[model samples]
Target: MSYDLLFTGGRVLDPGSGRDAVLDVAVSGGRIAAVAAGLPREAAREVVDVAGRLVTPGLVDLHTHVHPGATYWGIEPDPVAWCSGVTTWVDAGSAGAYALPALRRAIGGYQVRVPVLLNISAVGLTGRTGESRDLAHCDTDLAVATVAAHRDLVVGIKARIDAETVGPHGLEPLRRALAVARACELPLMVHIGAAPPTVGELLPLLRAGDVVTHCASGIALGRGGLDPALRRAYDAGVLFDLGHGSGGFAFDVLEAQLAAGMPPHTVSTDLHGRSLHGPVFDLPTTMAKLLAAGLTLAQVVAAATVAPARALALAAGTGTLAEGVPADLAVFAVEPGPFPVADVHGRRRTAPLRLRNEATYLAGRLLPPRLPAPPPPWIPLTAAQRTALAARDRRIRDLLTTPLVTPDDLADQFPRPPDR
Candidate 1:
């Protein structure tokens, strides 16, 4: 069959098939058709020679916030993720029952595949501290219905039950979220740290398919490192995610966790606009941090690609470079130097290595360069639309300015608002 593109002379590393060798890969119809030494380029349409770069399966970022208006925490998803060699990004609870439609609309027509985790809160993380604060917003029935409605895009359920975020109703909201997750037959991604319940209490509540994010965090009420309870959870097949967000990770905690043989199941940069420049720069930087923490090259790559896809239950070959798999690949350079990597705290550690993305390909197409463009002309709002928008804006403003009311009081005030 005629091919679309050929990538030649690169060191191919595919953990799925346990193959590592210098090979030429051929892409036909946007899928990998062959990987062998000295494959003839004569049958190909275009050839990209990457002699010295490391060619691996396209990276998968398991944790991110991609929803545009639903969550203002991060940069736009496609450019930030794809330019950095990430092809598939699992949006970590940026939308919930109410905002899923808008999130889908924002991302549906894009090339980059984004699987979203439905937040337990109906509104998702549209707030400064996140969306799990008001226990009344954690609607199990609505969350379950939303997941069922968008079964193709919604992969799992997410709940941030941190102390500062969840306030007093810590475990109660989590219990309700789990109930929703169970009803939908999907895994639950729990953001643990600085919470009311002890790690001991939290671990028992999770099952095999559940996920524990911020596993090495020092910010949680249980600032204690990865304890025996967490290990028990891991042993029981509960996945651990390295959600290295702006304020959740701690190098000390990570070191202790790694030392205790509790390696993270997936390595993800909880990247956002504020955290993009440092501490959690990007997916490659997060992987480099894991390497600096003593994981081997293969181990780090596996966590970033295969393991994350497995956790999300993406198609079998989606994150690997095996023949017949989609031709999504990343070319990277591993530079040797004393690279200073920091944790959530101001502490830093210098390691003798760093991985940087040299090039990225989605399917068989190279990503187009980002260009600056003029802003669009403002359109005049219709009288009816303007009035409705004004009313909605006022309601949101009032909700923000209102004093901290009980969940029951909030429920009474906003009784079963329609899903957005």
Candidate 2:
């Protein structure tokens, strides 16, 4: 069959393909139709010869905040994540039952695909500290209904059991989230850095398919330094996700865990508005940090792509370059220099290898550069524009002042509509 596009001559590094040699990949109708040695250029209508670059399955960031306008921390349009070689992004608990429709609308028509983890809290991360502080917001029934409604987009459930967030009600919210996850047969993605219960107490609650993000972080409930609780959790088949956010990664703790044979099951950047600027710039930077933390290049790539997709139970070949898989790919270059990688704490490590994005493709289509927003005109604002701006400001203020869902309102919101 004739192909739509062909990529040739890059060092193919798909672990699933089991062929790291130079090969040509042909795409037909957005799927990878062929993978073979030296496919003729005449076989395709469009061809791009990528030589001397590392070509792998597109990077998948499993933890991020892309809920625009709903929360102060959400990142809009995800800042060209695909341009940084990320093709799939999973917004981790940014929008819960009440806010998901708006989040989906904001991301409509984007090239990159965004899956989400439904938060147990009905309001999701709508407030500055998240809704965890208010136990009333942890609505298991509402979370289940929301996930059931958006099964295609909601891959799992997220619960942040941090100390400052959950306080004394940590386990209650977590238990409610787990119930929803069990009912839906979906995995639970728990954020464990600080907490009311110890990591030991938390590990037992997690089952085989459950995931624990911020695995090696040195914060309160984290493993600290190769704690036995983490090893036990790993042995129990609980997946550990390297959610390297601004305050969730600890270099020393990561080193100790790796040394103690607790390797991460997946690598992801918990990219949000505050963390995206530096330290944890993007997925590529997170991979670089893992490389510096002693993971092999192959291991790092697998954690970012195949492993995450598997954890989320996406298509088997979704994160691989299997013959019939989609044509999503990322081309990168490993720069050799004194690359400085930092941790959540004010610690830094200078490593020699760093992954840098060269180009990104989604279903064989190169992503376009982001257009800059036009500057405001110097002339006095028109009356209509002023009125519109004022209306918008008022709407934002109203949204902020609106009372959030309480745990007591869970039953009303789920399996039944709220009272008018």
Candidate 3:
């Protein structure tokens, strides 16, 4: 049988099936047709040699904000997603009921896979403190209705259940989000940082199939250094995701968790306007950091691929390179290096190995890499750009503080489809 494309001579490492060997992969239409050594070259219309490179299933980032032009925290996904070889990106609660219709409209145009986690709040993250800050916004019924309305786009519910996002409401927002998730019959992904309810308070409320993101953010969960609370949650089947945002990942906290025999169930980049710049450039960078922190390449690949695919409850063929699956895959050249890796706190570590994305195939087709965006404009400026604009410029302040976008901003972008 003739194949649409062929990838030959690559180290195919698919942790999902314990596939780690040099193999040739053939694609027919958009699904993988075969995976073995030495397929006849004449059988494929196009063949690419990938000797010495690592071939992985298309990556899935469980946390990101790609509602660009619609939310203040948003960014264009194609440029970043293509550059990083990520085929799927989950926008973690960037838009709620009022804004979801527009967010969905924006996502439909992108070629990438964007499964969203509906925000439990009515207004979502487009507010000063966040949607959960005011309990009035945590309309469980509204969120339930919204999820029901957009069941195709929304896979789960997201709630930033920290002191900063939800304020003194503590665990109240989490509980409400849980209710909405239950009502919608979807999983709940909770973002935990410094918390008033504490990690202890959050875990027991979460049942199996729920997720706790930012597991290594040096929050109350990591203060005591990887204890029973985390272990119990893991035992309860609560997935831990690395929501490595601008401030969510801390090496010390992660090391402690690792020492206690715990690692992230899935890896994700909380990519947005702020994090896409530095410290959290992309998912590979996040995965490389963990590789530097002692996770084997296989472990890192599993977290980024198969594990996240399962966590999101994606369709049957979502995260594997097995035959009959979508031919979504990535190629990376693992470079030996003393690469400088930094966490959110500006602390740095030198990694002995780094994974560099060389090329990617999206559903049996290769795409040209778009030029990467320059480092955040403010990063390279002089003292004047720093001090002169420090007090007056809204853009500078927004970049530095990384505040949540206001509801008015989203309303302007996705204006509620004129009443009937």
Q: TM-score winner among the candidates?
A: 3
List the candidate 2 regions with Cα displacement exceeding 4 Å: 221-224, 371-420
TM-scores, one per candidate: 0.85, 0.86, 0.87
lDDT of each: 0.79, 0.80, 0.84
Candidate 3, residues 152-258, lDDT tens digits: the string is: 99999998877778877888888899999888788999988776768888888998989999888875566555757889998889999989987789888888888
Q: Pairs clashing in candidate 2?
A: 136-406, 136-407
In model 3, which range of ten residues has the least summed lDDT?
372-381
Query: What tens-digit string does per-residue lDDT give for candidate 2 at 1-420?
Result: 789988888888887567688888889988888888888899899988878778889888888888755775677543456558888888899887889888878768567888889888888888756477777788777888888788888889998877766876757878888999999999999998665666777878999989999887788434456667888889999999988876788888888888778888999888876666545768887888888887888888899888899898875577788887878888887688678888878688876687777888888888776632221233134476557657766886797788777677766445666599
For candidate 2, the lDDT comes to: 0.80
Candidate 2 weakest ten by summed lDDT = 371-380
| Top model number, lDDT | 3
Q: Which whole-number lDDT from 0 to 100 does residue 13 have in model 3?
A: 90
lDDT value for model 3? 0.84
